[model samples]
Target: MMKIDIPTMRAQMAEGDKKRDTGLTEPTTITAIKELSYGPHGIENTFDIYYPVGTTTCLPTIVSIHGGGFFYGDKELYRFYTMYLASQGFTVVNFNYRLAPVHQYPAPLEDTNALMNWLLIHGKEHYVDTEQLFLVGDSAGGQLAEQYATLTSNPHYAGLMDFAIADVQFKAVGLNCGAYFIGQTGAINQDFPFYFGETLPEQTAQQFPVESFITTDFPPAFITTATHDFLKDVAEPLATILRSKGVEAEFHLYENPDGKELHHVFHLDQRNPIGKQCNEETLDFFRKFL
Candidate 1:
């Protein structure tokens, strides 16, 4: 296991307080579906769906997973951003998966995949386009999106899985300040052992490595991060690995003029120029691809 300083982690999180000054508000158009069975875990496996004002058919779909260092956060936290994407002619699905310390590695990953399977099976009923699927996630959620994409693309895994997931393909993926490496140290590590359990083997844990999963068949990706954020190094390394494998991956690094901005603040502060720019860049990227 890699060693990390507790005091340093606290200090880095404290720097994110700068986002509190930005005037960001929650979305009013979101409607929560508190009950959409996604996994065998029963009640906790539900997902929330967000859509535009008017009815539509064949619209693009985006699945958004929230970030909480893998141990915290809920589907409600990302309602605004999901609604914003919905407004742009895309159907948005925001779901809750079991967090770490409570559940573990494959648990959360399975929950996410189950939710996608559910959507693919019943998407048309909700006016969602099953054929046009895209994924967007922030922080740990971004990591999950990447992992899920890789799993779906790999014939060995997806083919053998008994889940309800159809052969539906992903159009594109957008990862913002994601922790590409789950079990590794540096920026991505944050009490990951609590999720995998203390007795789990190293080789077993390595299966979740985000960088190693990238493949030539993987969908196009748009990765972004800030200079002051600890995760700045995470996106570039993964992008490099993807490119080496002949995958189409694009990367962007945004630096905050104020030194106080930390990782995972883009969705929290909508008024900040940096936050708006991040949203714009992400939306533009998806629009072009989807």
Candidate 2:
């Protein structure tokens, strides 16, 4: 079993923050920006939008969700990535949903769905091509993205779907080191009680498992996992599930070229050769689909 050195990880995270502030490891630029709030859940339920300059015509949009174990991350932490995608000519929306231990299952998912509905309703006004919607998430965000896709497709969530402003179709989804399953086999399954307030019932837990929820109608997906990641098993099975359902799917496992690194190290060390290569491959994959 691979173990994460918490102290070393914290140091690396601090280093990344320093690099971000110094602009030495910034991603890219965005032309215009806006704040979006459509719910009554107070200021924390808001999102930021980034678009290219002079984009009057409808343009593709990518909604990015950040990850911090469902308890720590915020939209701002992912600004670099969103801005980079926006610079590539895709409108990018990054938002904060309610966190766990305060807001449990269905809350975060509902918040994301609300954001999606808001986007569809306001897409035309924002000059967005609602039909070309793409969902991208890293880690916890990826899990929510998959859940959102599943929820939107289910008739039980029809009321949620009815509020969508436009006839948006999810074209593709990108899962970066996502936690796709959340039961006994999950990496952080033990953390569920901490997040959910209590141990989840079997059925309740099943609802959050992307592998169990996926259907043939689920959109195409591109998923990535690091070889040394604790979550590697979490995402790989979902790729097989997607293919079995005839949904286009691609999965890549990245390993450290020097063979010395740990899970979730990619985002923290962007200058690392393997990390850079993974980002490049991700961009190339997006270009092919978008």
Candidate 1 per-residue lDDT, tens place, 141-240, comes to: 8888888788777765454344544466788888888878765553233446655666775545556555665678888888888776677778898788
Model 1 Cα shift for residue 100 (angstroms)? 1.7
Q: What is the lDDT of residue 271 in candidate 2?
A: 49
| Candidate 1 local distance difference test against the native | 0.71
lDDT of all predictions, in order shown? 0.71, 0.70
Off by over 4 Å in 1: 1-35, 40-43, 157-166, 183-191, 201-203, 206-208, 257-262
Tens-digit lDDT track of model 2 for 135-236? 888887888777777665554543333244224568888888887766536533465554554555554554544466567888888888897787888788
> In candidate 2, where is summed lDDT lowest over 10 consecutive residues?
158-167
lDDT of 2 at 56: 73
Q: Pick by lDDT: which candidate is best? A: 1
